[model samples]
Target: MPRNQWKPFQSITVQWISLLLVCLVALPVANASEPKATDIVVRAKSKDAKFIGSSMGGAMVRIRDAESGEILAEGLTEGSTGNTDLIMQQPHRRHQSIAEGAAAFRTSLMLSEPVFVTVEVLAPYIKKQARVAAQTQVWLVPGKHLDGEGLVVEIPGLVVDVLSPQTHRYTQMADAPFPIRANVVMMCGCPISEGGLWDGSQMEVAALVKKDGRDFATIPLALEDVNTFGGELQPDGPGLYQLLVYAYDPRTGNTGVDQVSFIVR
Candidate 1:
């Protein structure tokens, strides 16, 4: 073959080699931008107390993409409520983890770049009336783990359950001054007692009564036993009576309520 002919073929071959090298160099960069799995942890905690755990029915957790409003993960938190002394009594330092082995909802998201997410939690899941919802937003980075006491959503409220003067009860006016009883506890199901932790003596509990849909008496209930508050409700005449029982902690601004109805003959 002629030398000039060989020169042209060599130039064409060099151009193809250059293009191949460019593609090889760009491959890693493209791969780096692809989606990756990111780990996230979320927990629901009672205000001024422990985590919301299995005992009270673990909290429901939902993770959504902030920008798109797409759900990323949905599940319930599982495990214990955590150590009482560590979560409630001890002072916490920066970066201290109180959620070790505590209840949490864990999930992974596929993300290529940093993404903003909204985490919503409904705690004390079994108690519909006492359930509290909380939420928070965070930026998730690919490959980053939002673990170790992860994102804590604090729920503020008490669990109020009316115990006496049962719902839909029928009674005579003579029974008007009947006992009103209720059981109150922290949102985490922590017991409330007169002189113990989560003291009921420090809270205000009462029954707001209504007769035949009209304004009636407001009876203040006194702490009678562990998590129990009692009082008396007296109806003036024969009518439908409704009792709305409530508990409030003035110090923490936490409140909860439950209601019942009865008919007087």
Candidate 2:
């Protein structure tokens, strides 16, 4: 072949080699950007108690992208509240697995890179008035497994439900003393009782009364049974009476309230 013909062939050969090199160099980078399945476990824990689980109607969990507001995973925790001794009685040490058999919401996220995510939990799903929401933010690294105790969000506050002097009740003034009753429990649905794990005796339960929107009186409730508190309200004169019943634990600073209104004829 002539030298000019040979030059054209050389240029074509070099172009082909350049293209091949570019593809080879880009392969690893493209693979690195591919999404990875990352496992995560999330648990909703009642403050000073155990996990919020099936007995309490489980807890709803939502994992979302912190910046984008996109939801990554959504579900409810399943299983038990956890072992009473392990979660409450035993003293926790560093790296202790308190959630070995506890309830959890487990899911895998497809992540190409690290993500800042927000984990939100709404607990005791069945109890609308007593339900509480808690959330936390964390950076999730691709391929990292958040197992073991995983991400635990503590939920504080008690669950208070007014059981007597029901909402919109019409009472006769002849029934001078109106009976008041309430049920109080931990956020995990743990029973509160005198001399029990969660002692009702240590908590103060009361009913704050208001007549026609005016401050009436405060009546202290005594523990009547497990998780139950009862008292009587002696109305001075019958009108529209509102009752706000509350339970407070001085030691743990856990408190909850429930209210009801009734008309006396």
Candidate 3:
């Protein structure tokens, strides 16, 4: 192993190693510039699953750095029509309900590097306190897409259990007792009553029965328990009846409205 003999072999090996290193580093940079985007679809609804839609009609989605809390990308989950930011933009109309607006929110986000981040959903414009803020952690890979779990924000609103009618389309006889079972909660999913965070004195639940596009009768609901409320509806006559149940927490001025269309024999 003479020093002169080693020099020639070492030079060739050094050149081979440098070429290998260059290829490895250049590969990632070339792929990075092409820019792969991740499509994040957000869906919002009430915690009970009885209803699907935000009172605000749409929600805001923000992608933030999980560690630093810095927002990276932002977009909206609006009505069937795109860019429906606020509920007011597309007011409620016949056949077009609030649920139509809060159906799905879609956005594509692109990042230079893959990192751990948080997806934050906010429905602040919801006046009825029908929804709460939602956040979830997800791994954002630069070249792939990620789906999120269903984000539920309970509105301090009313949910009625139609025990008698079985189906929203089913008809109840005028003589049969249409017993109503309902649950009342705060926007944050806290049960409310006379002495809770939302004063029971100001809380009330009522069903507005509409016939022929006019107000027919208003049946008051009695609170059976903290979160349980019920009422019996004896329709004056048999026909097509529209029922609108309203739950209100006067303390915070949060209200929720639920509707049902049923036939009365």
Task: Give Cα-based local distance difference scores for all models.
Answer: 0.91, 0.93, 0.60
Q: How many backbone clashes does candidate 2 have?
A: 0
Whichever of 2 and 3 has more TM-score, that candidate is: 2
Q: What is candidate 3's TM-score against the reference?
A: 0.44
Q: How much is the lDDT of residue 245 in candidate 3?
A: 71
Model 1, runs deviating above 4 Å: 1-10
Pairs with steric clashes in candidate 2: none
Ranking by TM-score: 2, 1, 3
Candidate closest to the true structure, highest TM-score = 2
The best candidate by lDDT is 2
lDDT for each residue of candidate 3 in 88-119, tens digit (9 for 90 to 100): 24455654434433455666777667789887
lDDT of 1 at 37: 90
- Sliding window of 10 residues with minimal summed lDDT for model 1: 169-178
RMSD of 2: 1.8
Residues 1-265 of candidate 2: C-alpha lDDT, one tens digit per residue: 7788799889999999999999999999898889999999999999878999998999999999999999999999999999999888898899898997999999999889999999999987888888889999999988988977999999899999999999999989899788999999999989998899898899999999999999999999999999999999999876999999999999899989999999998
lDDT of 2: 0.93
Off by over 4 Å in 2: 1-13
- The clash count for each model shown is 0, 0, 7
Local accuracy of candidate 1 as per-residue lDDT tens digits, 2-27: 88889988999999999999999999
